[model samples]
Target: MKGFSAFLGKEVKEQLRNYKFLILGIVFAIVGLLSPLSSKFLPVLLESLVDDNITILLEDPTYIDSWIQFFSNTNQISIIVLLLLFSPILSKEYEKGSLVHMVTKGLSRQSIVLAKGTLLFFCWTVAYWMSGLITWGYTHYYFSDSTAEGLFLPLFSLYSFGLLLLAVLLLGAVLFNSAFVPLLTVGGFVIVSFLADIVPVIHEWNPLQLATRNTEILVLQEGDRLLAQAMGVSYFICIGLVILSIVIFRRKNIA
Candidate 1:
């Protein structure tokens, strides 16, 4: 526990020094602010773009629309930024020979992986929640009837999916020594997951649904069962990936 705490502290300090936290915070806050602002003004903006003679039939923006924008922005843009930021988790250390020194100094490989994963997860949670809170506040102010059923379940499911992605990236880092390799690994996984979604039988259990179907859950209270299943699968997959990373890192020959 002591070793894990020490390494976790080191990871946090490193992230702070690199300005990762600052970048993520700014990006997510902007996303939060934009979600509601765009939903509210998009109709007017579109109308302005058109000539006065043209009639643009658009529905009034609601809190649901704001939430849709929020999830879409977070699922696509925020997640990409997060993946890019942390893609080099283990590879950078390998390149710099930092892990070699730590291993030689009596740090266990499992502790290293666990600490880094925990720190990254913590940062992701904080950034995500900050954005969520901002979005909620703006959404309420804009639309007084902004209540959505089963909101927390969908949000948490999306968060779990993020953790699953991070774990997979970590495993990829352990398997390959290049910074780009882990990113490619994650990309390939996403592609395969998308392809898998084409099959009807797989929809209920697909982890990707956690990212894609959040709006449905928020709007209709639909997919509650699917959300639960996807969350379960995602968390288990995250744990499995972390364990696999530890096993592989232990056997890896560090030069």
Candidate 2:
């Protein structure tokens, strides 16, 4: 327990010293502010660009539009930022051969991987949800008629999906020596999940559904059984990936 605590502390310090948290907070803050601001003012921005003689018909924006921008930005750009920021986590240690010192000093590889993953997960969850909360608060303030039902389910599901991504990154970082390995692994998984979306049977089981089908869950009058099922599967996959990463790292020849 002492070793694990030290490792966790070291991971947190590295994140702070390297400015990972600062970068994540800045990116998420921008996304949070932009989503709602865009929802409220996009029509005016579009109108300003129109030809003088032409008038474009535009409906008043709703809270849903704010959420639409929120999910779109978060699921696309915010997540990509997370992946890129964390891709080097393990790769950098391996590349510099700094992990050798830790491994030889009796710092278990399992603890290192677990500590890093836990720290990253904690940081990502805070940033991700802080962005969403700010957007929600602003959207609600601007749009009085909007009420999001079953909001917790979707938000929790999205958070879980992010953890699953981090787990896969740990596995990829362990399996390959290059810094590009994590990015390539994540991208390939995304592509495979995209393909899975088209398959009728696999759609419900795929983790991709957690991100993509969120709007559907939000819009529908009732919750989705498949969302719940996918959440369960994703949670299990995250645990499995973390364990696999530990096993892989245990056997890796660091010398």
Candidate 3:
């Protein structure tokens, strides 16, 4: 962990130089705006697009609808883009043999993992919150007659899931030297989680609950109980992944 602060600062500088912040901010901001706008207008657009004889009775869009769109967009759009964006973080360096100079210069492999992990979480937290805040503001403007009760936990659950993803991505980056390998690692992890959730007994402790149960969390339903448990598991697994990644990277042949 020596020089962790310096390494993290370097990571931030590189990200800024590459316009990573600009790209992430703009993308998440657009996604946030789209959530409320699409939720409010999609029903109207559908009605207009349908055939005149077609009788499609859709419910009026509400704050709940906007929030639903928010979560969906965050998951399907924002998170996917995020994983793709950072998928090459470590693996690309391996391909370039760029990390060898740093390692030869007394940089700890653990520092690389720690710094990159910190950078990943920091970027995700900021970008995700920006998106959520934007969605919240517009959702309120469009659905003025809405309650703010029970919002924090549900939103937090989604953020926690993003952390879980970064951890898996970090481990993938350490274990493999290809950018695509990390994505496949994350994909495999998600697929297994989704499959495991099919069992009622397993669903209670499954970390995927944090990502999939936002509406349930908002309602203080049985899922609320399960979400809390899942968040704990998610963090536990995230830590384990970080540790495992560091251990693997320390021994990995990055060249």
Candidate 4:
């Protein structure tokens, strides 16, 4: 137990030392500030492009617009940032023989895997929630009278989706020795999800619903079933992937 804590502390320190925290903070903060700002201002920006003779019919934007921006920006940029930031988690250490040094010093394999996973998961949660909460605060502030329902549902769904991705990436990191392997693994999942969506029968069951239907959830109540299904499937897969990581890491040859 003590060894776990000590290794966890080392992982946190190494993450901070590598500036992952700074990158996470900056990226999420940008998304937070910009999501609402873009939602409110984009119409005006688009309107300004019109000539005097042309009139564009613009429906008054609602709170749903803000959330649309939030989920869109998150699903697109946030996932990419997370993949890039964590891509090196295992590969970097393997490249530099960092784990080999610690393992030689009597560090347990389980402790090392747990510590890295803990720190990575914490960073993902903090960055994601900070962006989300900030966007929520600004959305309400900027559009006080506008209402978008099911705000919490999409937020939780997005956060959980991130956790699922993190779990998959961890498994890829443990199973393969290259940083690019996790990126490819995540990309493959994304492609598969896209394909799943095209089949009408599987579309509603897709975990991609968490990120894709966020705005719809705000406007309509019907998507809640899809959200729940996504949450369940994603959580199940995430846990399975984490367990797989642990099992694979235990058997890995670090030499």
Each candidate's lDDT (Cα)? 0.87, 0.85, 0.88, 0.83
lDDT of 4 at 171: 84
Q: Which ten residues in a row have the lowest lDDT in candidate 4?
A: 217-226
Residues 64-178 of candidate 1 have per-residue lDDT tens digits of: 9998998999988988898899888888788889888998888898899899788778878998988988988899899877874667866787888888888888889889999
lDDT of 4: 0.83
lDDT for residue 35 in candidate 2, whole number 0-100? 92
User: Model 4 over residues 1-255: C-alpha lDDT tens digits?
Assistant: 777899888778887898888988999999998998998888899899889799998887767788888888988898789889888788978888888888888888888778778877898888988998888888888897655455777678778888888888888889889989988998898899898899987886778887777667767644556678888888998888888788889899977
For residues 175-218, write the lDDT of model 2, one tens digit per residue. Answer: 98888788899888878889878987788787777888767777
- In model 2, residue pairs whose N, Cα or C atoms come closer than 3 Å (at least 3 residues apart or on different chains), thus clashing, are none
* Model 1, residue 134: C-alpha shift (Å): 0.6
Give the candidate number with the greatest lDDT: 3
Q: lDDT of model 2 at residue 253?
A: 79
Sorted by lDDT (best first), the order is 3, 1, 2, 4
Which pairs of residues collide in candidate 3? Answer: none
